[model samples]
Target: MPRRIVIVGHGMVGARFVEEVRRHDPAGERASLTVFGAESHPAYNRVLLSTVVAGGLTAASIGLHDPDWATRRRVTLRTGVAVTAIDRPARRVLLADGTSEPYDELVLATGSRAWVPPTDGLLAEDGALADGVATFRDLDDCARILELGRPGGRVAVLGGGLLGLEAARGLVGRGVRVTVLHPHPHLMERQLDPGASGVLAAALGKLGVDVRLNVMAKRWTPELGLECDDGTTLSVDAVVVSAGVRPETDLADDAGIAVDRGILVDDRMGTSDDRVHAIGDCARHPGTVSGLVQPGFEQAEVLAGLLTGADPAARYLGTPLVTRLKARDIDLAAVGDPLVEPGAEWADASVEVLRFEDPFRGRYAKIVLRHDRLVGAIMLGVPDAAASVIQLFDSGAPVPSDRLALLLGRALPGEATSAGGPVGSPALLPSGALICRCNTVSKGALLTAWRAGATDVAALSKVTRAGTGCGSCQSAVSGICDWLAAAEPAELGEGAA
Candidate 1:
């Protein structure tokens, strides 16, 4: 008999786990699967919700699976239903509809929920969002926000984090007057240093996003708009809250499972109970620095391998830290820990700090190296440098000796040439260099897929999921497509496929 694997929460990571499991046990000879989604609709790309808020893409365009995907895979998928309880002793899942399903193994991918701050009047008596207040969490939030944020409307976005800034830019793009109220002194304090944060705030200001720093939302009422602790009231039609998120660990907590800030897991992503495991935002691993989709995707792969018995020795060490802000008119990528101080004991004698700022040009670059390795960096307004720096950072290879050129994005490793070619040019990246961090697609992988007849960007995305996550790597994929099309059919490495 096949091992019964039941999954909870059908967010991006949950759906990905399903796909990864199918890859190993395509014929279902080893494992049978069932997935439960709390949301009524099928899983869509949550990373691209910011773009949906920006109006560049529709809700229908970010779907991860087709209508008959489950049927074709011979898997059971239940959507718009809640898994209320996990009967651990019975090895079954109890649903809210008074039904239960048995499983030999339980995978938790519950993800997270938008963290709404305790601003007065923001929540109704029934604990729902008060009128004129919404979050930028899901597509449903996007629809409501777009309907209320009509052109000429005034909206107050509470928070200056990545999500807030994206929503603010989107609202401003739609001709809605936007004001970003951040409680912290700078935006994205966790990802960016003060210098980089300053440049980012200035760029947002130039883009018509009024950013207010070092201020907290004292109270929020539809009639009075938002009242600040600085004794000011900003009258607006709506409020979009993007403070942060808290992992959805209620199910794990309710069951007799271990949970900290998230569900605690070991190297194998197994919970305290060997039969129960967790991944994604809901699962807390040692090496995850931030709550991006990449780590979750990596975890899903590790769990799928172990569950299917394809690799009994497979273990999930951790995911490297790399975050990209998917906002228009601004290019930003943060790798490792860019906030390391020069005077800190660990960084004192060994670390080499370098920074170059050009606020007039809206550019800021900072790199912190220790022992000839690219340890940390914050690249802003420099897409070329970001592309190459991210490559060097991920490879853990020695950076080029010419620090200035590397900072300016004019230098690269020996294998790749940078002679006037765009930093995003496929020729300038080593074959193994990652072009898309979302699906972990590499330049070599794209070439292999192209040689195999997935020639265009859309086809490439369909086959390899290169530009599917946040759509940040769409241009890079397009550049690869153009280069492949212009070159001879068998120019170089045509047999890679």
Candidate 2:
């Protein structure tokens, strides 16, 4: 008899876990899967919700599964069903619909919920969102914002973080007058330094967003708009809160699972109970950080390997995260620890920092190297530099001696030069080099899919699962396809020549 696996949640990470499991257990001789999702819709890309808000993509465009996907995979998928309680002794999970399902193994992928801070009049007496107030976290929130965010209307966004900035930019594109209220002194303080934040703020200003920093919301009402802690108020048509998110751990806590800020898991993604595992944003491994989709996808792969018995010794160390701001007209990418504001006494002696800032042009680049290895980087308004820095960081390559040239996107020594300039060829990238961070897809995997007759970008994406996560690597994937098309004939004629 095959092991019966029950998975809770159907978000991006959960869906990826399912795909990975099916990939390894195609015959279904080892395990049978069942999934329970609270949301009514199938799994979709949450990373592209900002794009949907910007009118670049519809909700249907981000879907991950077809209607018959579960059926064809021999998996039982129950949408709009919440797993309320777990009866460990009975080895069953109780659903909100008064049903139960037995499981030999259970996986938790409940993900996280957007956090709303304590502000007056933000919620009703029944704990429902007040009129004209919404949190930008999921597809439902996107739809609500679209309904309320009218052109020529005023919208107040609370928070200056990545999501908040994305929402603000999308609303601005829709012709809404946007005012971003942030409690922090600078935008994206975690990913960007003060100097880069200043440049980003200037760029936002050019996008027609009014930024009010170092202020918190005192209260909010549909009639009176948002009142700040500084005793000031601004009228607006709607309020969208992108404050942050908290991992959904209530079910795990109630079920006696070890949990900190999120569900605690070991290197194998196993919880306190060996049969119960956790992944995605809800799982808090010692080495892994939450909120990014890359880490969650990595965790899913590790867990899938163990569960499918394909690689029982598989262990998840952690993910080296790369952060990108997906706002329109704003190009920015940050990798590893952007050692911003290091102590002056130890800064110069410990790490070499290379920085180039042009506030007038809204461009800033900073690269932090430790012991001659690329450790961290931040690039804005420099796509070429960003691509090179990310590749170097990903591959653990040595930094070139011409630091200024590298910072300016010039050709590194020993690299082939082209008429277009020093942009490295896609063919030079190692097969293992990651091209899609969101899905953890590598260049070699893409090439393998292409060699298998998946020639076009869309077909390659469907086959290798590349360029599907945040859609940030779509251009890179297209470039690789173009490169492959040009190189194929040359390779075939090598023996003849």
For model 1, residues 1-497, the per-residue Cα lDDT tens digits are: 99999999888999999999999999998889899998887999998888888888899988888999998887899998899999999999999899999999999999889999999988999999999999988888999899889999999999898889989998899999999999888999999988999999999899999999998899988887789999999999999999998988999999979999999999899999999999999999897843688888888999999999887788888887878888878888888888888887788677888898998788999998998898899999987787778888878899888999889877664333211123344564677777778678888888888878998988998888887776777777887788888866555453422
lDDT of 2 by residue, 1-497 (tens): 88899999999999999889999998788889999999998999999999999999999989998889998888899989999999988999999989999999999999999999989988989998989999998899999999889999999999999999999999999999999999998999889988899999999999899998999999888887889999999999889999999999988899998989999999999999888999999999988688888888889999999998998999999888788889889988888888544665546666888899998998999998877777888888877778778878877878878889788776354332221113246656666767877776777777778778999999999997777877788878887778777775654232311
lDDT of 2 at 192: 90
Which stretches in model 1 have alpha-carbon errors above 4 Å? 413-425, 494-497
Tell me the whole-model lDDT of each prediction, alpha carbons only: 0.86, 0.86
Residue 471 miss distance in model 1 (angstroms): 1.9
> Could you tell me the lDDT of residue 492 within candidate 2?
26
TM-score of 2: 0.95
